[model samples]
Target: MTRPLRVVAAMSGGVDSAVAAARAKEAGHDVTGVHLALSRNPASYRTGARGCCTIEDANDARRAADVIGIPFYVWDLSDRFHEDVVEDFMGEYAAGRTPNPCLRCNEKIKFAAVLDRALALGFDAVATGHYARLRTGDDGLVELHRAIDGGKDQSYVLGVLDQAQLRHSLFPLGDTPKPEVRREAAARGLLVADKPDSHDICFVADGDNAGWLREKLGDRAPNQGGAIVDESGEVLGRHQGTYAFTIGQRKGLRLGRPAPDGRPRFVLDIEPVSGTVTVGPREHLAVDGLTGIRPRWCGTVPGTLDGPGVTVQLRAHGEEHRAVVRVTGEKSAQTVEIDLLDPAYGIAPGQAAVVYDGGRVVGSATISATRRAAVSAR
Candidate 1:
């Protein structure tokens, strides 16, 4: 006989999450719902089908919990969220690194802080509406897999989850499609069934990160005008701020001059100390090798690959590429040397590199440096 697991569902007041919480109950888990108040100001939530972390979201989560017949509570995590996510976000940008706020939230807040709180409070596991599947392997290890709906798969955001977090986490909507989850929510009489998904960062009120940082960081937002240079150290133009540019960005470079070959220019590197944003032809963006630091593995320590056997995902919605990865660092400060079978463009530092073996998540790490193919200036 299976014992009923005591679970805490992290409700986000969205259709998918509402359905996930209900599914937890259906699975015979002794479930309770909790809404995280990530914003200090309750009314800061954008009006009409936009934004997250609003008082309305908390209320909707409570209502969903009512429909699920589970006890619900709203926890004020605004301070912690600001310190861990918002500040880290600004800090990364200030240091000339592009950081993914969602990935940080999942790693620090959702899985680490919330999961820890749940276990301390006697709950066995923390459940959410993330679109990722879990399977128990023959070795009794829980493996993370891509969701059934490839379009809605959230494994990219969830690749930050370590083995401990994966062990105590639940994702009920992984095997279900997004539409089916919405239908389940409607069938269960949850009002959030039709609530629009919050696609923007929860704390960013206007969805303009650059603008928001300017207001918050004030003179510290890296908005100082900087020189735009080419690989040969030739000054091509000037930019308002290095933060405004990312690797592979071309459109907004506003470079009055074009390359000698009349080809487009792309951002190749960013040097914050010197306030320089480097640009080059599109070919210069190609990087054949990458070294990743600050690593996290799902299960086993990575072994050498003889061929392009492993898959590497560089961006959230980006295509997976075949690569050969070699692990080369110690336990806590782990690193990996990845040799892409094909040239990967726009690979940047501070961006996470998630590895997979087929559909299962193998591990993840932060990109530290790149081995770019040299390009002759035209």
Candidate 2:
């Protein structure tokens, strides 16, 4: 028999969240539905099922709570979201790095801010629809794991959660598939059962990330225009802004002339200060290792790891790479060094490297530097 708990359901007004809230209630827990108001001007975000934290989504959440027969409320975290997620996103781009805002939101907003408030309000736990699983490890600590539905597993983004956050978190949809979740939602009379999943960056309504950055970054942009150079230091083209490009970007280079060999060129490096975008062959983009900073462990942090079971995910929904991970420095200054057994291409700094021990999530870190593969293009 399971003990009933007073849970706060972080409803995003989507099918998964609504279903999660209902399931928490059905499990004999005292559940309260709360929708996070992330944007101050919700109208600026996407309106339909393609967006999240919008005005329509809030209304949908309220209606879902009604159907679930639970008390509902909305919490305004707009300022926090803007500072921690939005501002950080702009900063990362301006610094010539590709960051995952969804991962940051999970770390800073969803789990940190919301969970803190829930605990202060006397809630025993916070429930959400994130497709990840929680399990008791041999050491008796809670471990984060990949969901049964691999296609929908979100453990990579959630790798930021620490031991305390995992303790009071509940993912009710981990064992079920997406189709089953929607079907269950319909059976529960939830109106958002068939709503399409939100895609792209929610704040970027038009899905034009570069254009949006240009509009918002105004004075903060590194340069209005800069030279695009090749390996030989030849100025191949010019770019409007360094923020518009990322490492491994293949298309949109619009180089005035093709390479002498006629092979395709890819963005190999970006120097924000100099506003220099470096283009090269695809083979030059391979990286054999990376150093990650600000490592966030799900449970206890390991000092050193070198085993066949150890794997690392460099991007969300990306395939894992066998790695030898080493933890260095103390607490706040700690860094993770990962040596990938297989060279990976298009890996960028500011991306997260979620380390896993088989199906269990050990931790995650923000990639700060990478060591290029020694091999040259044939």
Candidate 3:
């Protein structure tokens, strides 16, 4: 019989993590639950609320651990969270870029910081409730694959994991659907069996990041006012802050004049330096190619410029578009180019472009540029 492995499961006090701990225990592994303390705000907690990393969440994790018959602890990582996740989120927004804080949390907090801490504490592997799977390839290499529940697959957000991290991570819930997870939690008598899934940014419990940023960066919001123009450079209206908008946004631009064709205008670009919010028809947002930097691969695939064709996801919950990936530069400093099979809309710089071969994740990178083909004149 194989010996039981000591596993540290990151519990967010949600049904997923609670069931994950129970599943690990059922698999005969020695399990421990750890909840991250991600924020310093005292009012961040609501009784029986479904926000990750809150005091209430920590207590719920403790209760789940009790049911699973394992030890549990709360790790105070607020300082690092502030530095890596929160600060970056604010900086990206201020620069007129939409940032994915969950991706940052997965990269810095869960995989890097918490994994290091777990290893130092004598655990053989760290587990999470993420809806993704890790498997050993025929070549004895670790590979990341999409979870069985396609609707809940979180591989896009986790595409930043490197080979080393993938080797020591376990996602026991990947093969199970969310409904079954809840059933398992109930069968195990876990208190979080019916807990609502936490959807808002865990640290920003109130989902008021712009409001929070307004408070933290009072009067520091970019004020370089510029024209909101159309494709022909005709000024449509004025905008207060370009940082408040993102690519492909349609509403909130109080343009006084109607379009010549009576169509709604969408945000085409946000120029931070000039503080301009460019608006145009929806077709202007489509792009055919994307270039990104600092690529990270989870499997043993060679990190080279030329590769077989793969599918790329440009945003969370976005459709997977067929593409060809090419890497450039030395391993230490690399850039990736992805030529899409079909034009993708709302391709934004600073967003992640995760590549996949069918269900298996190939790698991912931060988008640096997006190129669109010029439409031929009729």
Candidate 4:
């Protein structure tokens, strides 16, 4: 019989995690469940009708742990979470860039904080319900892979994991579909089996990010509202706040009149300093290349200066584009240049460009600039 492996699984009081714990135990591992206390006021957020991270979730986790005969503990990580994830989120929004808090959470909280704590407590591995897989290659290097359940695959959000962290991580739910996880939870009589998944940003549970920012930052600076213009600088309509809009957004512009060409208009650019929201035909939004800053390679594999071709995912659900990656520095500072195969629309700065090689994730970098073919000459 195989020896039991000591594993600490992060339990979010969801069905997937409950089933993950069950699977880990079924695989003959000594499992301990941990619930990360990320928010000081979890009750304020409505995670569907179920509420979020409330006392109820902790109780449910404890009950599941009891059923599984594994010990359960809650770790208060609210301070770290706020500093690493929440503050960065607000800072990005204030800087006129859209930030993926989930990515930040995975990079800073899950892999860094939780993994660190688990190691300090003498656990051999840290596990989570994230829909991503890890594989040990012939070279003995750990590779991050897309989950078997492609529909729920979450590798994009976990692009920042280094090889060491991946080596000591387990994703028991990676091979199971969401429905199957729920079924497993039910089979084990776990109370979270039918519990609805938390959809909103765990911290900003209300889905009103702008409102949350307003409360935190007070009144925003009053920049003169200006025209939503076309590529030729032709004025289309007025806007309230450039920060409130994003690229490819078509609604709520409140244009006073219809376009002469009768085609729908979409926001193409947001100039925060000028408070200009530029709107135009959809074609104007396409771009073929993006430059990323602070590039981080997942493994110790030094990035090549000669550049290598890779598949780049610019957004969470965005389609992958063929690109070539070139690293520009050594040591603490590095930049990545990605040359795309085809023009991508609505590319936003401060978003992550997750690079993937086949099913294995390479690494990710922050989008700092974009180059449109038309504007490059100028």
Number of the top TM-score candidate: 2
**Highest lDDT against the true fold, candidate:** 2
Residue 289 miss distance in model 4 (angstroms): 0.5
Residue 321 Cα positional deviation in candidate 4, in Å, after optimal superposition? 1.4
lDDT of 2 by residue, 32-96 (tens): 99999999789734555455778888999999999999999999999999999999999999999
Full ranking by TM-score: 2, 1, 3, 4
Q: How do the predictions measure up, each by TM-score?
A: 0.94, 0.98, 0.93, 0.90
Model 3 lDDT per residue over 309-336, tens place: 4689988788988887878788888889
**Cα misplacement distance, residue 110 of candidate 4 (Å):** 1.0
All models: lDDT? Answer: 0.85, 0.92, 0.82, 0.79
| Residue-level error in angstroms, candidate 4, position 36 | 0.9
Error of 3 at 68 (Å): 1.1
CA shift of 306, model 4, Å: 10
Predicted structure 4: lDDT: 0.79
- Tell me the tens digit of each residue's lDDT in model 1 across 107-223: 999998898899999999999999999888888888999999999999988988878889998899999888888887788899988788877766776667767776777688655
After superposition, the stretches of candidate 1 with alpha carbons farther than 4 Å from their true spots are 47-50, 221-223, 306-309, 374-378
Question: What lDDT, from 0 to 1, does candidate 3 have?
Answer: 0.82
- The collision pairs in model 1 are none
